[model samples]
Target: MDKEEYKEERFTERCDDKVESIGGDYDLEEEDDSPVEEVRVTISNTDDPSMPCNTFRMWFLGLIFTAIVSFVNQFFYLRQTQISIGYSVVALVSLPMGHFMARVLPTEDFNLLGWKFSLNPGPFSIKEHILIGTMTAVNTSTAYAVDIVILQKLFYHSEKPFIAGLLLVFTTQVTGFALAGALRKFLIRPAHMIWPSTLVTASLFRSLHAGNNAPGDEGRMTRMKYFLLVTLGSFIYYWFPGFIFPTLGVISWICWIDPENVVLSQLTGSNGLGIGTIALDWSAASYYVQPLVTPWFAQVNILIGFILVAWIMVPWAYYTNLWNSKDYPILSPDLFREGGEAYNLTMILTKNVLDEKKYEAYGSVRMDSFFALTYGVGFAGLTATVVHVILYNGKEMLARWRSARLENEDIHSRLMRVYPEVPDWWYISLFVTSITLSLITCIVWDYMPWWAVLLAMVIAIFFVLPVGIVQAVTNQQPGLNIVTEYVIGYMLPGHAIANVTFKTYGYIVNVQALTFTADLKLGHYMKIPPRIMFMAQIISTLISGVINLSTATWLVETRPKVCTKDGYPFTCRNTNTFYSASVIWGAIGPARVFGNVQGAIYSPVQWGFLVGALLPIPFWLLARHFPNVTWLKYVHWPVLLAATSNMPPALPYFYTNGLFIGFVFAFLLRRYRYNWWARYNYLTSAALDTGVAICGLMIFFCIQSWDGEMPAWWGNPSDKNYDHCPLGAANYYGVIS
Candidate 1:
């Protein structure tokens, strides 16, 4: 048989096996109310109402993981190569811990206030496992507002009181919970709103709880055993790339061929164009794009977009001296003067506000060609997201919004209705309380005017649904950072603190809302009670916000030169990028950089907004006309444009390496080795992440904490660039320092 026929037969066999394993009346091939084929195969349509979810064992284990995850994420946020501990890692590690507690803890029931629960929750069901995953998932990344706090204390030389910082972090993180709760009917209840990543997590949870194999799988190794083996192997393998042979992270062989040739090195180096770069390190490769989890189609779109911009357009722009690119490094995130020296913020600002006299003498603030273009790309991404969602999902969304309840409720939604839904008033009260506190914190602390804070909320409310829809369907999230920064930069110039504060409120609120919505869908798939999920999410957000701020403050106080290049591995790459953005759009103001006031050298970049809005139209129209053209429907413009959004902090090699790996696993294996791909794909992704995170923490605490260094060798270079392409940082014009 041919490949397509073989694949179809295998898929049918798998679906039959899944139905038999689930042991339900619902037939996979005949159920009209089922979701897509992908969801049907991965998630069970059955539910057990007797499973214990809100037990003492759940809260104790959930809270412990939440604290550890928040602390570890915040610790790595300052490093040169930051690695996030995603919820999948937590899901893997917490399983054995929960089962062990079930065996050890007393089975006797306890009374708290009016409710009764047991300490040991009868062998730890999938409900409790999901709740623990939800709690850690909420705090997997550090709170967004912590970046503003770091920017204020380290870069701006001004610090806010601890209480003010706490309030800011708490308010920004949970205000979106209210928005998420309000919009559940349109975003969550519909079967078409699949939320692909949640399906992977749900699959992992079910597999962990499934004690035996199906009839066709008796000889194969179980998923849990495979996971443990892979995780152990990953932990042992990370030492070479993580410490002993650090150059394995970025094997730029083309640059090694002729490191002194500035143009060739700049094109092939890890820090530059990354034409032929390869990374053996799983942490570095999977840092930006989670290869195994992201769909192959989405990876293809991102690769196409990255190549067009990073390879073709950027080189053309730099060589042609667009915006005088020859004066600066071909690829950099730093703001510079006309002569290629770093812009001195202290000389131009007075008390964190721009000094008009000093600014006039300092000339126009400049960014490298790539940095300026990425902002333009970000502008395109935002508009493209709105347009793409409208073209693709508008009618369904409108119909869902108009109707009180969906006519065709999927089995998952029907199962979820057995539990009491979270009340509308619960979310409304939270929104009112958080927004009120946010207003007070901003006004009382002089962060921004009350009107700007309100406007920021307005922006968040406007964008959440469309952005959430895009993320729900595609695994990519188009950021609101550029739009927020541009809006506030124009409205209130020369105030750096006000810029970042507005950004945190406007950009992060939408992100937090989507996060809550995704978690709710996970609960929906796993059959956890709505009220229980709501309470777990809120509690976790509050706890995580407090822990995140405390950890960031402690690091800033104890570490000397904590954010500067002199800090070595702790150079705070992301925070520095944040500071550069503040200078470009806030303190320096866009008028002097992109506006006509200073001749508008980079003003042409603003065309991206129009370009993004229109780019989706042609492909959408073609897809509508040629419905048989299957590939046309997969042309997602939003994911394409947002591909390079993480360029500055994420090097070019991350995308190059990630896309290649994604192709190998998501495409090649899924097509050729269907059974192995289904059984171990997500497990492999989770194992690699967990192993790398544990090894990184150990290396820091045991070896690097006391100032011990990897003895200098060819592999462990003295310069620490790793790519060994020194000339990549030099400008073509040979500008003097």
Candidate 2:
């Protein structure tokens, strides 16, 4: 059924309620605040004529699956971070969660699995399992690759061990979860907010529940066709890379293809896209979906981001010859200096010594430094974003609040539900925690100045809103806080060179728009107290911060060869890792004459104002001149769930590990969502994820914590040898002179 019909049908009580007590028959009551309709769902055992079977098998399976998820989530292997653990584990756990949810939920009847299906028109609703399973898969799979890993790691310049570096991500997702929980009713029931991702998941459940008339089946043969599609799709993906279409998407003609190029080389080596844990992260939000049909929005996003970053940003740097090679300046590759530092023009890395020592430098950033900024932004701008969101969206929120309060009266009366409200103390504690932790990090390491520490916080506060939300749109995330960092850099006592420029007003605006895409997703599925989610994220931030540092130190210490190496092998060039880069850029403003306070504010991102001002002129002109083409409709944001890469890939790579997690589960569960197996799917997903997360954390402590790669020198691996220098801090600045 289409969305409206589905809601109409769903709201009307029928065969069974997933959580019947709370979700009373929508058709039965149409009161603005119907007491019965508000009853919350809970699990309860159905009357079983026979004894429950396989207790030992269930326990054993759960334990094994949980262990696998834990290991995978906690460790990094190959190029993949273990975030896939969530979907994979959840796929397995769905079995138990489904059984439990089914048992507890008040259903008119019960349906068992496997052989039991034929006994009595299927006692355990296969439909329920399918729905829940697909949702579980969607929640874990799409969110990570589309939102977190791709955006942060690839587009926004997030840390490799993002766990160690930034707070915004952990904070945002957790907050979204909590807020979504509280805000779900309004978003889902009547307001018409298209929770697109969740809808796909819900469809799966409906299908599974259909006894013979399951959703998505044109007929038994049509359903048979789906099984065939899966077989063919799976076989082609598995074999094509090793045997046939190796670089599936690439131009096989080879004439236009730059076979020698690193990116091209990597793609050439790519195992044709299948159920890969190996992510091709274009941004934290970038995903490797082989959509049979690409939407204009996604196509536009990729095209726009590519044009701006490649055509504008790269060229601007090249023209300036930052590498100092007037004859032949290199713009993109990594170069090592005897002294560990950002690619400075002065540093020579053997550029045809016979002819010239010309070299071009690349910019580097520290994760700690950036986090300091993000933390500051989270502190200051978070308030602004939240306040603005609430205030601007207040009327809607109030109505929702009132509606849920009334509707939930029946559910509360029945069950001892645990809808805990996150308190004021939690937020206050977070503020204090951020302050204390940052100070501890800085003072203990002595890597930056008190002013810089203050500056970092100041940095994060200024950029958080613009950076976060805009990223939600444009399918692009500019690192170095494209707008705020530039403004701050230009305005600072030094750093006004405009060394990095946010390019093209059209695309920059697009990029900036994608920031809140994750929040939008959370706004759909969850019903937890917003305040609680917000607080939980802050708490997660604290945990992530501590872990970030430990991991970063290991990466630096283990390899001891950073910028000097060819590619920034891991998340080495991350903002937090190059905290010192902040100072480097900060000192540039006073160096430039025109970069005074006013001059600083006049930099690029301020173009937001220009665009805001002039955008309407063209818009009105378009409507008048070419009424057929609505230019505004073409604008797209990367932050949408369709685009947002929140958790699918990243979660598996950290904080969780379990044996049962696997890529196929995510794909299979999603494909079968409309089957009878849908209902218990989501519950199973949650269980699997939880199990894997627990195991992943344990694995982190066992292997990752103790056996991590340690840095050899105090500087980037190539230039400075720590063997000669003290184990403490060493300045690569000595080599520059």
Candidate 3:
């Protein structure tokens, strides 16, 4: 059913006596005496008796999808333009697969020695779908430890045993997962602390499991049929840009028309400011933000910032030669030296230790103006997140904390009470075990001091609640990755391995916690047993660590120059950025780069922190005094900054296409055809994403990529400028002098 019909159904079902007992909505503590209107969200309450969670089918399907999705995640994680199978794809594919197995496999219980089991449990159930989605979700994002592996191999030119790498990945990923479980009372149990993304999955489950003759069954089936049609269309259409016609990925007509003009190419090429650049590649457009999953409200704020920085600011800066932009590429993630060559990291490093004498001679490292500004914008985003949370969500968070202790409950929470809650001790035991394992791995393999591991966990613990609050409310995660790296780098300067070790634990613990908490909220919405959810997540998380590390090792060994300019599709831009971050924050150290005010190219970048910190104050004041200003409510300072933060990993065309499509659906279509938008919007997203990912995966294994040779023709050019831009387009990789 659509959102409006679902709400109407709930309105009829709800009574004043039971209103306060339901789960999805929460009460915010108000400092002002404005009357708060009660808003209610209704979810599917129907349950099928035929399906039992934790059955053989769930376990079987969960493992199968987890392995496949984990491999997909790792493969893309190592690529220049990363892609992954969203949980929606897993949900969409698993439902039919589960039912097909149910029809074919024997349902009769079999006795094996003293055990009784059935290959096909009754009918494939909604709980089984939830289990599969949850397991694969755990593996959907690359394991945090993969970064450590990438840095070692690419930056340090060293390799660790595969076993050690796997162990580290498992330890780091699971430790934070355990912590998220331990804090479930605060993050998960409360009905009002809604994880927004979970709602989409919950809706999908409800629609898939609706009885044949149920009230909205016909509409739900239509939606499903529509989703399939879109999926098929997307799957077939992807072959063009994905393989046969790669120029379709970046249809830079402006560049095509003026291919010989350097200035015009700089303005319109994919590697340049990308004015009027069109991207037909789904992977490029949705790399950072998934259009279907994100609320239009959030998308608008992000797009405003993206347009300002990428379309307007970056071009202006480059043309004006801001921060020596003429000396380097306008859009590159690579660090540079004064002579416009790739920063020769060896000159400033001896045995992974900073060489002060050589560094003084080399002068401070320079950054492409665009790359430096991106960090400055990210810093602004970080500070703005903290400040915005305080001004906007502080009271709501306080109220939630106060109410979490009381006997307050919601409908879903009440339903969940039937199952035995997972014990606190289970998480405690897991945390202790993983922490011990992590410390052992760090000390033995990386020579990181025991104390550094303890310090990292402490950082994770302190930031979990605050960060959790922001994400739970706004659906945006202000990263702790940069802050953690800087903190550890300063304390343990010169020890590159130890700095990275500390940075991984410090940053990833919080990230892992948030990931697990999101899944827990999903379980809560779907009414899956909490204990079962815990098992699925922890098991999948552990498995993902091994799979991800193994994949990274394979790629690094076989494709030695994977992140280099020559690597193209396999260039590992994300990994290269991670390597650069390690070099800047670990090897040379932040103090040396940012402290030398006279020589440092990034000296002005530090002001972003202060500017970001101060920015939220005036907005808050305006919001408080002039509460009637509706536009002020939309001014999310942090989200604006976060939009610019995606520029390096996401091309200028990403935002251009994303904004046009996002606004068309989110604002125009949503306002005019509200019901159609509600019904088919997410359905279209799920179908398109699934189709693109499936086709992309097929193309990788079946064609184009197998021989590592490109068929030279007019269509597929050799200079890497497939769109046929001018010579200036080459600067995107590096403008080496």
Q: Which candidate ranks first by TM-score, i.e. highest?
A: 1
lDDT of each: 0.83, 0.31, 0.76
lDDT of 1 by residue, 313-395 (tens): 89999999998898888888888888788888988899999998888887778888999999888888888888887888778
lDDT of 3: 0.76
Candidate 2 lDDT score relative to the true structure: 0.31
* Model 1 bad stretches (over 4 Å): 1-42, 111-115, 190-192, 403-414, 469-477, 733-737
Model 3 residue-pair collision total: 5
Q: Using alpha carbons, what is the TM-score of model 2?
A: 0.44
Q: Which candidate tops lDDT? A: 1
Order the candidates by lDDT, highest first.
Answer: 1, 3, 2
RMSD of each: 7.6, 14.7, 6.7
Candidate 2: residue 257 lDDT (0-100): 49
Q: lDDT per residue, candidate 2, 1-737, as tens digits?
A: 79767543332222211223435433323233212221112111111112221122222333343334323332222122223444323433455454564455443433355221111222343332332232222223211111223223332333344332343233322332322333333332332233243334334333433455555544444332333344344334423221122222222222224423322222122211011122222111112322211233454443453334333443353335322211121221222232334434223213201112232232221111111222222223223333433333446545544553454433222221222334546545544554555454434433233454455444444444344432222223434333444445544433211111111111222222222223333322333223323433333333433333344344444633332322222332222222222333333331221233322221232233333333334434455567677765444322121121211122211111111122223334446653433434343433323433344344446544475533333222233221112211111111221
Please report how far candidate 3 places residue 45 from its true position, in Å: 5.6
Candidate 2, poorest ten consecutive residues by summed lDDT: 651-660
Q: How far is candidate 3 from the true structure (C-alpha RMSD, Å)?
A: 6.7
